[model samples]
Target: MIDSHEELGAELAEKVAAAGDLEALKASGAFDELMEQIDAGRLQIDGKDGFLNLMIKAVLERGLQTELSEHLGYEKGDPAARLLPNSRNGSYPKTVASTVGDVGLAIPRDRAGTFTPQLVPRGSRRTGGLDDMIISLYAGGMTIRDIEHHLESTIGTELSRETISKITDDVLEEVMAWQSRPLDPIYPILYLDAIVVKIRDGHQVKNKAAHIAVGVDLDGVKRVLGIWIQASEGAKFWAGVCAELANRGVKDVLIACCDGLTGFPEAIQATWANTTVQTCVVHLVRASMRFVAYGDRKKVAACLRNIYTAPTIEAALTAREEFAAGEWGQKYPAALKTWENAWERFIPFLAFPPALRKVIYTTNAIESLNYQLRKIIKNRGHFPNDQAAVKLLWLAICNIEDKRARERQKTRTTDKESSGNHLVEGAATAGWIQALGVLSITYPERLEPYLS
Candidate 1:
């Protein structure tokens, strides 16, 4: 036993030394040779300590050497290397912590100290995989402190909160890129909603609204187009948001469903003159119930439902009048006024066929997204600034979308006929086909051009 252990230690030391010997590694073609052996069943990678570590070492060293070659404008043995003022200055050992384990890398250096390798950047203690893990945890609503504890408990890595925060901060650039990405020329439906969050502005923490716009494409797939932050929303603010969407290539929105957003209809009309602004029936009901007594909520909701569920615009108006004159409406006049306030937007919902009504009657699509988002941000009591808030929200959105994609992929494997547009928990807009048919007929000129 003692002799076998000694031999193992010696083999390990040799492999460690071999990792730093870049010249010998290159001349031997060790990576390709090892791969060939593995392919031929002469050697194996069993996720063990020595060989896997050696494999990681060889790959990192080779990559660094290639980067150095590119930087110097010559290969290792090329006669053209001598013409350049800079050359390889050997390598230093670096142990990068990856998901598999800690990998000892032979980071190459240049004579002029100008070869900054990007594969595993200089001074980086861990690989990009570790950073990605941290970002994923952060996106899943783990606070920096929680992530620190999680890494320590799981991987035995004691990363500082600041370090974890910096890792997550790298997502800001991606957020900016995603925010400015172009959209489709037209959307069959758009769901607009706002989620209020606390953000510190200067010295004082104040409430702010993060407005999200979700556009449903011709294929019935919903994607969050963009997120805009504002201290408060107004006609000018909403108009700016609409203009940004328009500039991002949204030529028109056939039907935009939203909660009672002040001046949102005007903003939509300003951007797309023919865009139909539909108030969310669920939101209107909830708004009316805001002033109603808790005990009267059920009765009030049923009464208000009659207004929104009426057969036609004329019937809806009559139902609204009946509700206002009814005892419950007179008892809760504010609830009645809520319906009166959104009557123009509400009538559009009445005009749509039942199949299309189910899609446009509410902003449930965006609301479900916001529900997940709230869970992510709930741990964050308040963001330091708007940018910080946007960054975290964007990461959370990415995490949500990724989970949905995985679900769709899984569903595709099992049920080949399933459309990939399903959201979380296999929930999607039912009757999208019928809804789309209605939309095409209603706006034939605008909708048909894109269908082709």
Candidate 2:
């Protein structure tokens, strides 16, 4: 038992040593002293009135004093103070809320009354980081009221809903700018989808579709083209959406993937005549399974997989005939008809090479994005207006993209393997090289011009 305990302790020490810079800190003795203080109960590293809050208080006071010294051109107790008319006027007590807690600060003043501390500005009751925290919580799907209660429970800081809303509202201008920004001239693939969100229309709450367009550029980075809110969708509405994209600098889209919606293909063709409209095969499979009995779903899915997985369109057609003749197909005629109706749109992807075919047929890129968006808006029972919904959605997208960027940065700096935190947006599409090569060969005339 003694030997086992010794071996365990040594193994844990070895792992800690190999962890990272923390090993160097442990070697420096500073971390050891901190741990000693913590063990002795002389330091409390957590809670509202802890070591961190004390450090924050010290830093802010030190910063304010430094600013005052710089402004008056001398140290607080320096003999040079006699030469200047402006002298130290002591400090006034002010309590400000921070991420740690409420920190009481002795805000230094000048005899001249001209000094202003930029670190913690006058009349500001919360640190900049506190506002950032509020915005982050809001982006994470917390309502203003929820955030208010959270801060109060965590840090004993009470904030009004109006104040929280104002802080979140700062992102609205950014949302507008992003919505109106220019897009790439050419997108190799575009995925169109909508998520239903409830919004108040006058006296009653109505469900609205917030349409999203995710475009994969030639470089394989997924980009959100724009978002649109509509009560209902049709050929005319989609045409306007396409036209809006065109107006925002999208010159061409090679292929647009969407679920089977009436006149949707027509709308895409009207805008970009050469663009191939591909129906989402996953949606087709799901629709087929809707009418199937639960016990037979797996079997039915297995049988229908033969059609989509077929090598060629003709083979797919033959497979479809086989499925139509099968027992499940006979039992559920509507299941087969769903495929038959979408056959024209579904078969376009069958002609592509295997790699490109996989990329085109899989709607996982947009489906993942919609899944995230839905989770974000799920708690917000309803929005007041379209802009409110868009504002929240845009912030959520920014949060997702920001996290991916930071993870990539950390991986690069640490010289460690990727965290595997790849997101569809701002990251290369999976198997993009093989897919791009096939696309280049398939549509050299249209694709090659934009490749360079």
TM-score of 2: 0.86
The local lDDT score (0 to 100) that residue 224 gets in candidate 2 is 79
RMSD of 1: 6.9
* Model 1 pairs whose backbones collide: none
Which 10 consecutive residues of model 1 have the lowest summed lDDT? 418-427
- Candidate 1 residues 1-452, lDDT tens each? 42443334334434545656766655657645555655765453433354555556656677777788888888888887788788888878778776545766668888888888898876788877788888888888888889888777765566778888888887777678778988889988988888989999888999999988888888776888888899975667878888999999999899988878778898889999999999898898888888999999998888888887888999888888898788997899998888898888888877878989889988888899999999999999999999988988877887787677576676554332422222322234568899999999899999888898
Candidate 1's displacement at residue 133, Å, is 0.6
**Model 2 regions lying over 4 Å from their true place:** 1-34, 409-427
**Candidate 2 local lDDT, residue 176:** 83
Score candidate 2 by lDDT: 0.82
Best candidate (score: TM-score)? 2
Q: Which whole-number lDDT from 0 to 100 does residue 147 have in model 1?
A: 85
lDDT, candidates in the order shown: 0.79, 0.82
